[model samples]
Target: MNKEILRLPLYTLIAGFILGIINLITIRILIRGTNEWTLEMGKTVFYIELILSIIAFVFIGILLRQKYNRTDFFKSATLLVIYSAVVFILEQIMQYWGFYSMINSYLYLPVSIFTVITSLVARISNLEHIKWLHVIPSIFAPYLFLLFSKNPSENTAK
Candidate 1:
């Protein structure tokens, strides 16, 4: 579905925002408390993050699948690489700056491989990996996080 000018990076922004807020809020929680989720909880979060990251890539594929048909392998390769770099940088920032905990180590251990898989699978899944599949995780993770987080009371950061 080649649509005119439905920018994939826009989806990236949306996905980044999802991941960014997760970084912010989770970091805030860690800063307030221990920043260490239980192994069970951490695994849960990792799975969730993996899901989100994958969705992000898959969505990018879906969104720009049409435009992608025209795009070349080098362009696709560049975009995949860019996605990896962005994931890494965000993970680093989330680890140190926002969350700022050894909990970062926990998040990182699982996610590095997760991100790699996200890159590979999404790239293959997409006729044009730059559009729909690439960006969907960004859109999904936030809402899912909100849905699942155990709020004794809703902490609306409004």
Candidate 2:
């Protein structure tokens, strides 16, 4: 396999992860109080991030279609899923170590959407037999975080 096939997706994953952390920080900074307007602003920022992530995923999906075949698509998807899992594990460790806080459950929704969109695009464009088994990880990545992360109410009670 061409090294670019592996490198491109890894680079995109790292960039997306950094941008997600930045987005989380920005949202935290923007919502200074419990006011309605600040909450609305935070939601707006979240939606914007979600849209931008979808756009990036779509572009990458098309690029993969143009440059690679079904096998390559599988390789890329596997790499993405593995990298996402590693990142999630690291985030959990950071939270445990008190170096990071658990993100809102809503924040992970975009990641699940991105993964699904990428897989669908690859399946449709490459005409590949994408097994449901292969897609399970993509579907559950966000929900895994949601399940494991501390609830906001639980946090406040402490």
Candidate 3:
């Protein structure tokens, strides 16, 4: 059996864990001015998922570049999109498993958007050609982040 398949999840999990810590620090910074830490804490799971997807996009790009020894923007972008979807689905499964607070229903779109931005950055920094269509996903990322940071489900009945 090829042992390489076993390393994939390990890579994904390490990527996820690092991004989770970054997400926690981000949450801390965002909530520093507010009085409701407990409320905000419940949203950490969503942020962790979002941040993990973003980082995973870049990580995947790096891996592809190293493997091919060239920048293939379209290929990397497509893979990033697919990978983001998989991660989002897995997060939903974990939430259903009661591993974290319920994922905010509105979470998926924003994370997908941010994943595009991060992937683009990774490509551009490595001198990949700019594809205008690829820019679409990042256009609303800032606003989406603001929306996502608010914990939309916190006050509602699921």
Question: Could you say which candidate leads in TM-score?
Answer: 2
Quote the positional error of residue 157 for candidate 2 in Å.
63
Native-to-model Cα distance after best TM-score fit, residue 133 in candidate 2, in Å: 17
Give lDDT tens digits, candidate 3, residues 1-158.
43333233344445545565666687777678887667456456455655567657556545533333212333333444555566556755876898854353234332343544645564556656645455445543323222222133433323
Q: Which candidate leads in lDDT?
A: 2
Name the lDDT value of residue 108 in candidate 3.
38
Better of 1 and 3 by lDDT: 3
Clashes of each: 24, 0, 0
lDDT of each: 0.47, 0.54, 0.48
Where does candidate 3 stray beyond 4 Å?
Answer: 37-52, 64-158
Worst 10 residues of 3 by lDDT: 142-151
Quote the RMSD, in angstroms, for model 3.
17.0
Worst 10 residues of 2 by lDDT: 141-150
Alpha-carbon RMSD of each model: 15.8, 16.9, 17.0
Predicted structure 3, TM vs. truth: 0.35
Segments in model 2 whose C-alpha atoms lie over 4 Å from true places: 10-37, 101-158
Q: Work out candidate 2's RMSD over C-alphas.
A: 16.9
Model 1, position 81, has a per-residue lDDT of 47
* TM-score, per-candidate, Cα-based: 0.40, 0.50, 0.35
Count steric clashes of candidate 3.
0
List pairs with backbone clashes in candidate 2.
none
